[model samples]
Structure formats: C-alpha cells, structure tokens
Target: MIKKLLPFIGEYKLETILAPVMITIEVALELMIPFMMARIVDYGILGDGGMTYTIQMGSLMVLMAIIALIFGALSGRYAAIAGMGFAKNIREGLFKKIQTYSFANVDKFTTASLVTRLTTDVTNTQNSFMMVIRMAVRAPVMLIGATIMAVSINPQLSTVFIFSIPVLGTALYLIGKFAHPRFLDMLEKYDSLNEKVQDFIVNIRVVKAFVREDHEEEKFVDNAKRVKDAQLNAEKLVVLNMPIMQMTIYTSVVAILWFGGNMVIEGTFNIGELSSFIMYIMQVLISLMMLSMVFIMLIISRASFSRIVEGLEEKPVLDDGDADPQLKPENGDIEFKDVSFSYSDDAEHAVLNHVNLSIKSGETVGIIGGTGSSKSTLVQLIPRLYDVQSGEVHVAGRNVTQYKLNTLRDHVAMVLQNNVLFTGTIKENLKWGNEEATDEEVIEAAKAAQAHDFITAFPDGYDTELGQGGVNVSGGQKQRLTIARALLKQPKIVILDDSTSAVDTATDAAIREVFREHLNDVTTLIIAQRITSVSDADKIIVLEDGKINGFDTHDNLLKSNTIYQEIYESQSKGGGINE
Candidate 1:
C-alpha cells in the first residue's frame, strides 16, 4: 500500500523526509529527559552537598524537554498538511479519470461505489499515511535507543528486554493478520449501505406514493447492521493487541526488578542506574504500542488502495473513430442503411434491427411509435451514443464513424426524454448550448421554445438559482428551459425526444410554428407519441418493434396507412392530445 500511494506525493518529498527526521530528533530528546529525571532524583536530592552539579543538570533537563515538544509539534503539523494535500490531489485525479470514461466503463462501477471510493476510501489511506509519518518512524527509533541505553546501564538485566520484545512483535503480527480480512469486509458493507441510501433518496417520491416508508426503513436497518457487525468483529481483534502487549512488558519489568534488587543489595548496581533502567523499559513498551497502531492502520490503508486502483485501471469500451480531418458536410442529410445495435455481447436482442431511412436536408421529420418501438434508440445512434453492430449511419453526407466525434456532435443537438437541469441560473443553463451566446441570443432561444414569459415572471429572472436538478422549477418550465438550451446551440440538426410532453397542445403548436419560421434551414427530428404532435411535419415515420412500418407526409399517411388513421381517430375522440 505504501508503494501504491508513493506516486501521489510528487514534489512533497521534502515534507515527507522532514517529518520523519524531526520525529527521530524528538524521540532522542525524550529518551534523554527520562535519564535526567533519574539524575535529579538520585544525585540532586540525596547526593553530598553539591548544589552546582544539581542546578546545572536540572536546568539542562528543562531545556531538553522544551526542544522535544517543539520537534514533536513540527513533525505532527507537517505530516498532517502533506497527507491532506496528497489526498486532495488523488481525489481530483480520480474524478478526471472517471470523466474521460465512456458509458460502458462507468456502468462497471455504480455511482454510489464511486462516491465511496472518492470520499471514505481516500480518507482512510490519507489517515494511515499521516500516522506512518508521525509515529511509525519515531517509535522504532525510541525503542532501539531505549534498549541500548538500558543494556549499557546493566548488561546482566538486559536478558528481560530480549524476551519481552519478541513476544510483543509476535502478538501484534497475529492480531493484524486476523483483522485484515475483516476490515476489507467492512468496506464492502459500507459500499452496499451507500448504494441503498442513494437509491432511497433518488426514488423517495415513489416510496411515498406507494407508502413504503416502513419497508425502506427496514431495508436500511438491515444494511447498517451488516456494516456494524463487520466493524465490531475487526475492532475486537484490534483492541486485544494493546492489553496483550502490556502484559508481556509488565512481566519483563517484574523480572528486571527481582534481579536488579539482588544486585543492589550485593553492592554491584547503583540506585540511579536501576531507576533509569525501569524508565527505559516503560519507553520501550510505549514505542511498541505505537508500532502496533501503525500496523493496524496499514491494514485499513491496503483495502482503500485496492479500490482506488480498480477505478484507475478501468478501460473505456468505446474507441475513438479514426476520422478524416477535411470532411465537412454542406447539408444536414441523414441516412441509416441496415443498422443494427446491441448494448452488450450478452444481450439477447438488438434494440434496433436492419433499420433503413433517409431524410433530405432542412426537412422536419417526425418519428411516431408505441412504447418500446425503439424511437429514442434510433435517434441516439445518429449522435453515436452507441455504435451500431452492422450497417452504417451517415450524417451530413458522411459516415458518422468516419467523422471526428466532436465535429459530428457539433452539428447535432438533442433534448433527451428525461429532462435534466443543473444547479445554475436560467441564463447559465441556456449558455450550456453556446458558451459565447449573448443575452439577446439567449432570450431569442427562450422565446422560440415558449419559455420567455414564465422566466421573466421569476423574481430574479435569468439570474435565479435553479437548485439541484431544477427542483425549484415546475416540470413544464424545465422542459421548455431545456429546449431553449438546445436551441442556443444553433446546430444544423436538432432532435427533440418527446421534449414538449409537459406543455399544453397550444403551447406545443406555438413552439413548432417558431421552429418552422426561425429554424427552417435546420433539419429537425421530433419523436412523439401523440398523432396531433406530428400531423404538420413535412414527413412522418411510424415505427413498430424496431422496424419502420410506414413513411410519408401526414396527409398521405392518414389516407394510405391504417395505423396513422387509428391514432388520429383516438386522439380526436379524446378531445385532442395533451402536449
């Protein structure tokens, strides 16, 4: 895990080096302070009248204590800042990588899983990095220094140090190995819990409409309890390590005192030396405790690093088409010859099959079909949202696959069936279509989409914040705003996928009239379910089960096609269709 996270540190190598160096100095200073305390106790208070030596040693100890505190604080401050900055860079890099991924790659990892990776997992790795720098290096230095000092004081009693250190190391290793798998399980449970909560919030309206609040609560509780159980199991293993280590060190201390007491009575060991030995043993035990914490953090960080690598290594399925640089179409002529497409290899059937169509430049084409007739799927192919399995889709007189994606999409604009609005001002949303559009151009597009009147009535007008997903706006207003956004692009081709479904029939008619008058030079494709919606188009195509059944002008289709006549009759009987 340390190797994996090393690259994110980048130019902060100096900070990383300084943190450990400062910590080592602090540990050495701490060891000296304990020995000075023994000096103050044995020599200053009980020695032959020697005020000069006692005062000098005591003042030196105070100065060393102050220096230790300064180094410790500097080490902690630098480690924390470096860890936080490194984590921020990792998260930003991951987000940019995700943005470049195609739809197929994104589907491999769900939104909630990505969110967990970006936030909770990154935080875990960052905290571990901080702890390693702040304590991992200093602990070993303090332990080794204390051990050498104790052995030098009295080699006869050093046998207890060798016995206790090995026991502490073994106990920590065993507990860490057992707890590693449990921490990984806990991370998985957290992902599942996040997914459930996200789904509930997104579909809260449905849950309320069906009165399933209690059912959702039960589901959430079950997921939360699973996370709690995994966490508890891992914690039980980790908490046992501290006490076991303490017990081993305590036993060693008892043995040391027993041997050292005999030596004291036999006039072999000094009182000051024995006192310093006991203090060194305590320092070694605390150092072991810090080492144990480092190991536990390493286990948690390993799990988080795996998730980050998984996201970084994912491959986008869509390949960039090798496009011609000098290919520019003079008109918005479109053709699909024997087109067929399936979302994946395992899909049982194609969403579009052997479809054939042709539309002249600047023609208003209407696509009418029943539910699941693949109307939206057909239009999506023109923009290369999903490439066809066989056959060709030509746009502006060139194969779509042979044109650069940016160039091909630049000439086309689509308002999807599911209207989406970002959190921004009205003017900001419209400018998404054309970033450089002037205020005059924005208002013109809004009026063409029949959105100007309602927008002007708002207190802040175009500057009002829309809130998340435009929840502050009504459905009809949102659809019209989206249409205005698409209109501002001023593309050669426009596809409205049932965009006016929320407006009244009169408003829909007015919008269509505006399209005819102002956008006559641009080719328009309208996908709708209502017969009245497509009755005035220059051409209409009726689709059934992924195949075109009929294609003609509305007047000719009404006379020649029974399906068109039936749709018109049904809408007329229902006192006209809603927009």
Candidate 2:
C-alpha cells in the first residue's frame, strides 16, 4: 500500500526526502546538548575548570540549541507540504477513477462510503504520513542515541530503561492489535452515520410532507449512537496506552535516580554524569511514548489506507479494450442480438432474456412493461452503460463495445426516469448537453421541448438559478427542462424513459408533436406507463417478466396480446387516450 502511494508523492519528493534528513539533524543536535550540559557541570562548574570554561560550553550549547530549533521548524514545514500534496493528488486520482466506473461498478459502493473515503479517510492518511516522516524518524533515532549515551555513562542505571523498554513495547503492540480492527469497524459506522444524514437531508421535503420529522430525527440519532459506540469500543483499548506509559516512565525515573545517587556517593559516578544519565533516561522513555503514539496512528491509518486503495485499485467493469480506435458510432440504428443482462453475475435469472430486436434509423418505438419488467435495463445497453451477459448490443452497425465509450455515448442521449438538474443557471444546466450551444440554439431546444414559454415567464428566464436537483421547478417543468437539455445534444439516438410522466396530456401531446417535427430522423425509444403515451408510436413492445409478451402497434396489441389488452383497458378507464 505504501509503495502504491509513493508515486503520487510526485512533485513533493524533495520535501518528503528533506523532512527526515532535517529531523535526523535536529535529533543529533538535541543529543549533543545533553552531553554538552554534562561537560559544563563536571569540568566547568564543579571541577577545576571554573567560570571561563563554563561560559564557553554554555555558548556552544546555545548555538546547538538554535540550530536544532531551526532544523525542527524546517522539518515540520516540509512534512506538511509533502503530506498535503500527496493527499491532493490521491483525491484527484480517486475522483478520476470514479468517473471511469460503469454503472455496475458504481452499484458496488455507496455514495456515503465513497465520500467518506475521499474526505475523512484521506485526512487520516495525510496526518499519519506527516507524523511518519517527522516524529517517526525522530523517535527511534532519539531512543537509540539516548540509550547509547546512558549505557556508556553507567550501564547499571541504564539497565532500568532496557527492562522498561520491552515492557512498554509489548503493551503498545497488544493495544494496537486489539484496537486496529475496532478502528476499521468504527470507520464503517461513520459511513453509516454519514449516509443517514445525507438520506435525511436529500429527502427533507418528503419527510416534511409526510410529517416524519420525528422519525427522521430518531433514525439519525440511532446512526450517530452506533458511531459513538464503535468509537468508544476502539478507544477502550487505546486508553490503556497512557496508563501503561505513565507507570513505566515513572518507574524507570525512580530507578535511575536511586541507582545513580548511590553510585555518585560511592565515588564511581560524577554529579555531572548522574545528571546526564537522568536526562538520557528521560529522553529514551519519552521517545518510547512518542513511538507508542505513532503506533496508534499507524493502526488507524492502515485501515484508512486499505479503504482508499480499494477504490483506486478497482478495475472498470467495462473497458473499450484494444478494439479498433477508428471505429465510431455512425447512426442511431440499434440491434439487440440474443442479449441478456443481470445487475449481479450470480443472479438466478436475467433482468433481460435472450431478446432479439432491431430498429432502423429514424424510427420512434414505444416500450411498455409491467413493474420489474426491465424497461430501463433494456435501453441501458444501447449506449453500453452495462454490458450484456451472453450476447451483443450493436449501434450504428457496430458493437457498442468496439467504439470508444465517450464516442458511443456522445451520439446516444437519454432523458432518464428521474429528471436531474444541477445547481446552476437554467442555461448553464442546459449547456451540459452541448457546451457550444448558443442562446438561440438553447431557446430553440426549449421551444421544441415546450419549455420556452414558462421559462420566459420566470423573472430571470434562461438565467434563472435552479435549486439543487431543480427543486425550484414544478415536476412537469423539470421534466421538460431535462428534455430540452437532451434535445440540445442533437444525438442520432434519443431515449426517453418515462420522461413525460409529470406533464399533463395536452403538454405531452405537444411535446410528441415537437419530436415528430424536429427529431423525426433520430431513432427514438419511449418507455411509458400510460398506454396513450405510446398509442401513436410506429411500433409498441409490451414486456412481461423480462420477456417480450407482444410487439405490435397499439391497435394490433389490444386485439391480440392479453397483457397489452389488460393495460390498455386499465388506462382506458382512467381516460388516458385521446382518439
């Protein structure tokens, strides 16, 4: 995992390298200061050397301290640069990877999980990387340097740290082992918490309409409590670290003071040496404490790193492969040859069966299906949003997989069942269909969609800012706006999946007229629940339980197909048809 992340450290390579080098220099200077203090006490202050020698050593100590401070500050600055830069690159790379994922790939991960990985997980890894380069290097180096000095001064007193070090190390290892999995579990709980919040906020209007505010609040509190419980469980093991460190640190300190004091009185140890020995013991033990903190951070960061890498390493389910790069979609003619698909590979049955159908360019066909009849799934294959399991889906005289994904999708425009508009001006949102569209072109497309008059009635007209998801617009208006946007693409194939469900029959009829007038040459597929919506199509396909129960015009279907006859009769009672 570390090796994979190393490449993204790219431009920050110098900062990453310099951080540890500067930290090492700072540690060296720090170690020298203690030794210099020993000299000032033993020879300059207590023994024959006196004031002149003391002043010289003191001046040198101050210089080393200043250098150490400068090095410490530089290491911190470089560590921040490297850590933040690495995170920025990872975020960009992760988003790009997500953009490449097919719909099936997106189904494997939730929105909340991805958001958590991009934000909180990345932050955790960044902080860990910074500490790893700075304190991580300094801790071990200081421990080793302090141990060497202490042992040389007097091995007997130093043995106290030797005994204490292993015990603290063992405790820290156990804490990390017990806490690592819990931390991973905690992160999962955080994902759930975020999901609950997102779900509630996105559906806030629905909640209010249903008077379910109390219910939503309870749901949010339950998710938040789950997160708190998971976090507390992980921290239970981590909290042991502090108590163990305190006991070991104080025990080692008392042992050194006792042993060094007796040795000094016994004439084997000098006062300066004893003082330096105590300082070295403090350094060694404090370094161990810092190391334990790093250990805990590593445990959390390891979990976050694994989650991030999971996203980055995922292979896109659909790849254009080594197909002829020059191959391009030429027209909107579509064919499904014995095609079958299931969202999951292990599903007991396919959402689409061995269906064979062909539509010539410029033909407008209507598809009607009962619930769970895979109406959306059937058309999704045209643009290769999902690959067929057993057979082929061809567009423009070539298998969709042979063309570049962007090239195939560019020529096939879909207005999905759920009409979505972004948070932008109406013109900006429409520009998504064709970035180069002019104001006149935009007006024309909206006029074709029967959306221009109402749009002009708005105070800002084309410049009206839409709330997120176009919440500011009526449902019928939002649908018409989406239709206008899709029309602006001027694609050879247009798929409207229940795209007129919200519009009144009059507006629906007018929009169909516009389709006949302006988009007559483009191959169009309409999926609708109402029989009247498809009554006038060139052909109508009736699907039942993933199979084509009937394929004919409305009048022929009502005469021959039982399923179509039932649907037509039901909608007829509701006065759905005009003629």
Candidate 3:
C-alpha cells in the first residue's frame, strides 16, 4: 500500500530523504545530553575533579542542546514540504484521471464520494507521510540508543526491560488489531455524511419549496450520530494504548528505584550513574509511546490511502489515445449501424436497441419520443459520450472509435438537457466553446442564439458576471446563453437535446430560423417533446420502446407512424409545450 503512494512524492524526493537524516542527527545529539549530565555529577561535583570540570561538561551539553534544536526544526520544515507537496501532486493526478473517464466511468462513483476522496482522504494520507518521516525515525532511534546506553551503565538494572517490554508490546498489538477495522468503518460514515450535505446544498431551493427543512435536519442528525458512534468505537481502543504504556513505564521506574537504592546503600552503583540510568529508562518508555502513536496513525491513514489509490488506479472505461490524432470529421454526416447500448452490460437491459439511422450533411432532423424512449441516449452516442455495447457510430466517413476523442468531440457540439455554467463573466462562459473566439464572433453567435438582445440590456453587457450555474439568469435566458456558447464552437454537427424547451415558442422559432439560414453546412439534431418544434424540420424521427419506429419527412410520419400520431394528438389536446 505504501509503495503505491511513493510515486506521488515526485519532486519532493529530496525533502523526503533530508527529513529523516535531520531527525537522526537530532536524536543522536539528544541521547548525549544524559551522558554529559552523568559526567558533570560523577566526576566534576563528587569525584576529585572539581568545579572547573563541571563547568566544562555543562557548557558542552548546552552547545549540544542548541545543535539538536536546530536539527529538529530543520526536520519539521522538510517534513511539511514533503507532505504538502505529495498531497498537491495526488490531487492533480486524481482530477486529471477523472477528466479522461467516460460517462460510464463517472457513474461508478458518485460526485460526493469523489469529493471526499480528493479532500478528506488526501489530507489523512499526507499527515501519515509527515509522521512517518519525522516521528517514525525519532522513536526507534531513541529507543535503541537509550537502551544501549542504559545497558552500558548498569546491565543488571536493564533486566527490568525484560519484563516490561513484552507487556507493553502485547497491549499495543491488541489495540492495533481491533482498531483498524473500526477506523475503516468510520471512514465510510464520513463519505455518507459528505454525500448528505452535498445533496442538500445542491437542492436547497427544492427543500425550501417543499417546506421539508425539519425532515432534512432530522436526517442530518441521524447521519452525524452515526459518524460519532463509529469514531468513538475506534477511538475507544486507541485510547487504551496510552494508559497501558503509562502503567508499564511507571512500574519499571519504581522497580529501578528500589534496586538502585540498595546499590547506592552498598556504594556500588554511583549516585550520578543511577540518576542517568533512570533517565535513559524514561527515554526508552517515552520512545515506545511515540512508536505506538505512529502505528495508530498508520492504521487510520491506511483506509484513507486505499480510497485514494482506488481512485488513482481506476482505469477510465473509455480510451481513444491510440486512435489517429490527425483524423478529422470531414462533414456533419452521422450514421448508427445496428447500435445497442446499456448502462450495464446486460444486452436485454439496453436503453438503445438495434438502432440504425443515417443523417446527411446540412440536414435538420427532429427526434420525438415518449419518456424513456432513449432520444437523448441516441444523440449522445454520436460524440462517443458512452460507447455502444455493440455495433458502431460513424461520423463523417470513419467509425467514431477511429478518431481521437478530442478530434471527434471538437467538431460535434452539444447543448445538454441540463445547462451548466461556471462562475465567470458572460464572455468567459461563452468562450468555453471556443477559447479563441473574437468579439465579433461572440456577438454573432449570441445573435444567432437570440441571446444578444437580452444580454445587452444588462449594464455590464458581455462583461456581466454569472453566479455558479448561472443562478442570476432566468431559465429561458440560461438556455439561450448555453445555445450561444455551443454555437461558438462552429461545429460540423450540433445537437440541441431539449435545450430550448425553456424558451418561448416565438424565440424558439427564431433560433430555428437562424440554424436553417446560417448553418447551411452543419447537420442539426433537435430533440423536443413539442410536435411544433420539429414540425418544419426537413425530416423527423419517431422513436418508441428504444427502437426507431419511423424515420421520414414530418408529413409522411403524421400519416403513417402511429407513435408519432399519438404523441401529436396528446400534445394537441394539452395545447402544446406551453404547459
């Protein structure tokens, strides 16, 4: 697991190496302080060597302390650099990988789960990396070095460790063993909590409209309580680690004082040497406590790292990397050959079934279907948003899979059913379709989308800033702006998937007129529920039960296609899309 994370360390390799080296130096110098104190007490103050020797040893100890402090500070700085740098790299890597994922890939993980992995999971893993580089080096070095020095001073006194060490070790092993799974459970609860919060925020207006604040609050309380319970279950075991280590430490100290007191009475163990031995024993116990802390943190971070690794290592379900980069769509013509698609692999569960359709360049085609008839699903295949489970989608003259994704998608622009806008100025949002679009081109597309008149009414005009998802705009205005943005692409193929539904019929007619007159070389596909929206199209397609029931001119469809006649009559009785 640790090996998988190492690559993200990348340019931080220098800091990673330096942090441990600094910790080693700091530990070595700290160990010498007790030895120096012993010399000052035993030889300078008590032995024939007098005040002058004591002063010399004390000065040397102060100098070593200063050096150790410097090294310790340096180690902390390096660890911070390495840990933070590692986290930044992983975040960028995860986002980059996600961008390559097809719609099917994104469907595998929810938006909330991905956000938690990027934020909470990455933070936990970074802290573990810092602890390992700093405390991980300090604890074991302190333990081994203190043990060796204590043995040299009095080997018989060191025998106290033979009893105490095993007891502390056994307690820690049990704590870690039980605590790991609980931490995993706690992390799962965090994902759920984040999902709940995210869903509420995205739909806050809906909640208020329905007057369901109290119900939503009660659900939040339940989720928070689950998180608290899971945390306490794991933390209860981890808390045992400290009390057991403290008990072992205090027991060893009392036993040492009793045995060393007798040796002092017999004048065998020097008083100064006994003091230093006790100090070394304290260091050993404290180091053991630190080591235990490092292990506990690792247990917590292990779950977080696994989630991050799972996201990082997920293979995007779509790949066009090996396709010909130079292959370009020559015309707007599109063809579907016996295509079948399912969100799942089960062919019987398909949303689009055995579909065959061919659209000529510059033709305006309307697709009408009842709900769940797969009108949107059919158009999505042209740009390869999701691959067909069987058969092929052809653009221009070649199968879509033969062209690089960027090349294929660049020439096919879609204004999706859900219009999304980022936080930016009007100009900035429009430029998403064509980053290099000039001011003249921007105005022309807006005019063609019937957005220029309303946009100019604002004081800021093209420079007006939009809120997230363009909350400031009316539904009809948002739809027009998205249409303008898509038009800026100057794509060979344009798809409006119920995109203009919010616009008034008059404006909808004007936008269609613009497409008919101006986009003479571009193939246009309009998916609409209103029969009037597609009534004047060069051709109309009627879909039913995931298959093409009829594909012909609108006049012929009204006479022959029963599905089309039924939809037309139902909407006619309802007075059309205005409802």
- Tell me the TM-score of each prediction against the true structure: 0.90, 0.96, 0.97
Evaluation by lDDT, superior candidate among 1 and 2 = 2
- lDDT (Cα, tens digit) per residue for candidate 1, span 219-271: 99999999999999888988888788778878878988999888889989877
Clashing pairs in 3: none
In model 1, the clashing pairs are: none
Q: What is the TM-score (0 to 1) of candidate 2?
A: 0.96
Please report, as a residue range, the 10-residue window in candidate 3 with the lowest summed lDDT.
570-579
Candidate 1 stretches greater than 4 Å from native: 38-49, 164-169, 321-331, 390-392, 397-408, 555-573, 576-579
lDDT of each residue in 40-131, candidate 2, tens digit only = 99999988889999999999999999999999999999999999999998998889999999998887878898899999999998999999
**For residue 26, what is the lDDT in candidate 1?**
91
